[model samples]
Target: MAVLAAIDIGTNSIHLILVEVDESTGATRQLRKEREMVRLGAGEALKKRRIGRKSFARGVEAIARFAGVAREAHADGIRAVATSAVREALNGREFVEAVRVASGVDVRVISGADEARLIQLGVSRGYPLHGRVACIVDVGGGSTEIIVADAERPRFLRSVRLGSLRLYEEFLAGHDPVDPNDYRRLQRHVERALRPLGRNLREYGYDVVIATSGTALGLAGADAASRGLPAGRVHGYELTAARLRALQRSLLRMTVGQRRRLPGMNPRRADIIVAGAAVLIGVLELLGRTALVVCDRALREGLVAEFLDERLERASQSGDPHAVRTEAVQEYAVRFGAGGEHERTVLSLSLSLFDQTRALHGLGAADREILYAAAMLHDIGYYVAASSHHKHSSYLIRNADLRGWTPGELMIVSAVARYHRRSMPKERHPEFALLSPEARDRVAKLAGILRVADALDARELGVVDAVRATARGGALELEAETAQEIDAELAAVGGKSDLLAAALGMRVTIRALQVERDVDQRAVAGY
Candidate 1:
């Protein structure tokens, strides 16, 4: 087991966790935990500036305490991050510098998308996520992280500034003027800002709605305990479609003091819990999810889990480049909903050609990895935009921040995706030249392999089951073993051979082979 510590300094609180993780199985157990209610958003609304002296000091003190917990745990690594309050405030830099000086911990200020991605990572790692389209909503003090995922992979991720602290500062300013008109106005603003998001989320219809963060978990935990449910299984705690509506009405009727005194309600969270619940209710209604499942894990656990998972994957990989590349591509293909057999066939063929023509292409292991990745993710862009899908693939590969991949490796994958169809790499293209001379050469070579492989799966079906490559004289022969001869796939492969020939300086020969009964035949071609 490896120990990793994560500290999250947010607008409302500072939290730390010491997690003991089993690297081989991706199992995580929390050893120790600590949190402080710093209220870093205090007076930000009245001042229209940032967190003031008292709040900043409170945050620094919290960090100092967390540093002690991390050290005592003998943590192998520690990740300290700050969210919306620090990112939005003018004096955030000063506050972060203070924490660094006081606690010797560098704080990473994360963007909203980064926050949402991390939140999803944490929740998915902690839960049993199998074949469900999970929509995770983390309603925090300064931001709300909304991530829509299909099982273990993220589909749509976003973060909004509609949070408990922001709402409290805007509407619940003074207790005296908390009139019905003021409440109605706040409601209209929230509904309007959410309308655009609601419209865009129609295609990504979610099956299970998972709520995370302290406030969301508290609501779900309290509600579940009220109904005589299990304790920690608050995660995936179901609030039925009808029950949730009633809860919303009940929450709106209760005052802050009344909420504090309610059974299972945390006194510290009573003031902002209403605002958090409102946002979650809005998202649930918009997404048409019948029940909301609460997740106890979120951003902090995500950071630790990621570190643990990487260590495990590296240990399992055992330094085989081919194994590592294949594992990565296979995981990605499964996550992105690509046909597994089709990807395997394409990869087998592309790698064979790459190895056979190494002298012609003059590429290395890295280049081969790029080719495999491009083959696996060739259709991922279809998930985002279809018209200019190649370009979309390039953008996503470049910017998605995939783990275990270097920037140089990502560039090669992006270039391969870009050149798979329509346009080829130009002399003046900016991203193309960013690669080193050796990498550029590898990109051109691997792009040829990707183009041919992707074209072979034009129908997006698992027709081609196997492939082989052979070098005869000055020609390269590719033989594909198929259950049936896919005419369209062959036509597509034939069209791409001209470009492949121009780039690889060789004649391309392709042929289909047949099998009898269950016996698989070896694809054959000669030059």
Candidate 2:
């Protein structure tokens, strides 16, 4: 037997679960569970994209205490993962480093996609999904992850930015008793965001819907109390859409203080419960499902299951390490009508430039990979509209269901692709501004290189065969090997080299050199 502790660092709270796993049977027995409402993503922190001093302190203290508890329990191992709050924050790495110093545990900030995957894993452990197609919905403090799956594997996974705390802050925070106008606006926002999710759920078609997370459990408890049922164990409780709508209406009519006094209500969750209810009701209505089953297991429990699975050497159906990231990216690009000779040429040039300018850019292999993805997808926005295609590219990248990428990585790629053509990275752009200082710099550098590479193939005739970069005294020179004259490409480079010059802190000059080549080796190698 092995003892383990799993901590879920969430937007609204930090949760700890201690369990003892039997190696022989691969079964786990829960030892203890703890929750602290640190509200890491509360108020202006979410809007400003930074963790506040007070919240950061509270979060660190909570994790330290929890780590101490795990140590006291003689845990053999500890696994901690952070969700939307830390994942989206500009100072999220700062918070993670602080927690590590305070608790001696490294926190992994999971992407929305991974969060959804783990939620399904945890829910499946407690509630059997055998032979039944199920839709799992988890409404957290800062984001919601939805999954459509069967007994064998998940058919779809999606993470939306809407959550109880986020919705409250955005729409209903100021009003004690929700203003009618504010409530309508909130509903509209939720509906609009969930439209695509609704379509996916309809197409996948699930036999049952499952709801997890604190918000769901609290709402389920309240619903049970109202119906004169035992609210002690809410696990596996069936909450109908009609009853949920009624609960939402009643909660909205009451002030926070009044809601806090309700039977089975979690006093700590009173402020955001209404918004949570609205999100659940909207999802249920969208699926056209009459009821959803509440599961108490969520991310923390999922961590425990994963730990045990690793020890037992159990292979997960959906967790294939051999799957190629390029395959997923290529599929997504094709969906957006983005792949062709031009895109291929731009991708080759981008990789070549990134590799050749490594010393100047000071980037590593991981960043080079991000640049590869951004280059392949830079022009996908043309499918939407020719005008302002850069902006459209950013949106498509963010929304695409590309596997094997974290949310932060996707955001960086999106920002890089967005700035490949038009304006440089600035603090005014919300997407660009949301990134951390380090990430912003990375985007700027990668975008700068992308801009130059794209300009080299401006005419799309592939006039430039290859570019060799050499740094001189405070200046960079690019020699392009090609048989044809690249006057048009040279002019385009002149127009677009400003960003690169600023990034490298030097002047950039490019000239085409006449050369003969039997075949383009770089193009043939599929760079």
Candidate 3:
């Protein structure tokens, strides 16, 4: 069993979870977990930037404590992610640097889009969705993530800056409010901002609302207490739309100090509970639902599930010989920002080119996997730096703790991507040396397919309709259909025919086909 720890550094809290993974049996179970509300965004909220004083110190202390616990738990792996607060802070680097120096932990700052996806994943794990269209709302101290998920996945996901802490700061910026006008005005603004979600809500035809984050859980706790409910039973608790309205009214009547003393209200959340309740109230009213099903799990669980899924797939492929090559590559494509359609176009061309000369190249499952991952992650380097982007892409893929990929698998993907551009696999490259002798040879063989795939879409249009492999004579024929004239693409391929020829022992011809109209490109890309 491999023990893995995931640390989530949120604006309002820091959480650590330790879990043991059994690779042999594909079993995972949590061992230990701890959560602390540090309010890392406390001072930053007033400055509109990160203030590396109290928040930074608190974060470091929390991490230090987590490190001791992780060590005692004997964690085999560690993964840390920073949420909206750190991402928005101008001096966020300083805080991260301080934490790293203090606790020896590297933190990944996930984008808001990624945050939304992870939150949805976490919510789904705790409460499996029954309805096809569901709205996932995570109201945090610094940001609110709303995901409109369909039968397929999230259709529209957005993270708004309307969090409880921010609202509290705005409302209490001055002296104590003389009347309820301040709270009412904040409610109106929140409703106005959330008006756009109605468009997607109506479009998706949603039937269920899923609520996550501490705010909802706290609300559920309070409501449960009011109704004489038992503790530790609110994970799947449902609040009817009407019940939620009544709770909001009761909470609104309390002052900040009063809210702090309420049952289930954390001392750290006293000032922000009102604002969080307001945000949820707005969502409830807009969706025309009186209650929401509260889920205790959020992004932390989502991240862990994603990690587990990746590890499970990797283990499955290791055990089975017939696993699909596209499984890993498509995931790589998603992390690399490659368009699904383009990746499919590239995959089709790559496989077509590989199949035509399999007799000479002798491509195996592992080789095919390398080809697919390379094709999927070929453009990831563009996100970091465009200049000499092939090297950048290699660096990013090699360093990224991509789920479902081992260090060796990441090396192959990186090496394949490295050769996707001008340079071929060199014997002296560090990444090439890291692979086993068999893998190094495979990388060289697979790089030929990647180079060809990269050149096939030289025009960057979704025009490459289909690719076919035909070996009639001593030569291999690569035939593809394009919507428009692909002279540049052909020219690009023309330049790389020799690399393919050298690897496959025969010259390759690139041709444009005109007789294909049956294939669904969308399905091929999993879109």
lDDT scores of the candidates, listed in order: 0.70, 0.81, 0.70
- Which candidate, 2 or 3, would have the higher lDDT against the true structure? 2
My TM-score estimates for the predictions, one after another, are 0.60, 0.60, 0.59
RMSD of each: 18.1, 24.8, 19.5
Q: Which ten-residue region of model 3 has the weakest summed lDDT? A: 518-527
Q: Is 1 or 2 the stronger prediction by lDDT?
A: 2
Candidate 3 ranges with C-alpha deviation above 4 Å: 44-47, 150-152, 173-179, 316-527
Best by lDDT: 2
Q: Residue by residue across 381-438, what tens digits does model 1's lDDT show?
A: 6656678877877877787555567777787788887778776677677658777776
The regions of model 2 sitting more than 4 angstroms off are: 314-527
lDDT per residue for candidate 2 within 1-527, as digits (tens), equals: 67899999999888889876544223244567788888888878888999889889989998999899999999998899999889999999999999999989999999999998888777765564434578999999999899987534567999998889899999998888999899999899999999987666788757899999888888888988888875544767888898888888899889998998888887788889988888898898888889999877788877986786565443323454323455566556657655433555576677778878888999997897788788878888877888999999999998887777778889999999999997988899987889999898898899999999899978664556678899998988988876556778899999998998998899999998876532211110100
